[model samples]
Target: MSTLVSKVLVGSAMAVVSLFASIDINNASADELMTLNGIGKGKAEAIVAYRKNHCFKNANDLSSVKGIGSKIVEKNRKEITVGECKK
Candidate 1:
């Protein structure tokens, strides 16, 4: 491939990566939650379940979930977003 084409592809990939790097806790599905740094199937499911009854106001609220903790929230800080949830 030509240099220009390669650069364009790389830029597009980076943009996509950055776009998904931040996840909205208020609306993320179980699979989306799994993309977090320390989140797994179980944790992701728990987050969804918890979200059903509670609206997380911030990334720190994730720690309140059964299997989640402050460490996980801290690690995924940059990846978590709080919006459209309860104030």
Candidate 2:
């Protein structure tokens, strides 16, 4: 039982780590962006729109979007990255 619990905990941790590692802000779709902390449909759409005209260099760049603030960016900082914009 203890060994099973350990495996479950490790599996959950790896899932979380992989999820964070894959959320690239520069190229994520609205649906994908919505997975971040505090992001909803509207904010995700706004992110997509803002991204269309601008390039994100870092997670902090998300604070420039109309509805997104520094707090939101900070919440997802470890879960976000700035990858090449999908063209």
For model 2, the run of ten residues with the poorest summed lDDT:
16-25
lDDT of 2 by residue, 14-85 (tens): 998767665888888899999899999999999999988999988888999999999998888888988987
Cα lDDT tens digits, model 1, 1-87, are 999999999999998887667799999889888888888999999888898899998889999999888999898898898879743
- The TM-score between candidate 1 and the true structure equals 0.78
- Return the top candidate by TM-score: 1
All predictions: root-mean-square deviation over Cα? 3.3, 3.2
Instruction: Write down the TM-score for model 2.
Output: 0.75
- The TM-score values for the models, in the order shown, are 0.78, 0.75
List where candidate 1 sits over 4 angstroms from the true fold: 1-20
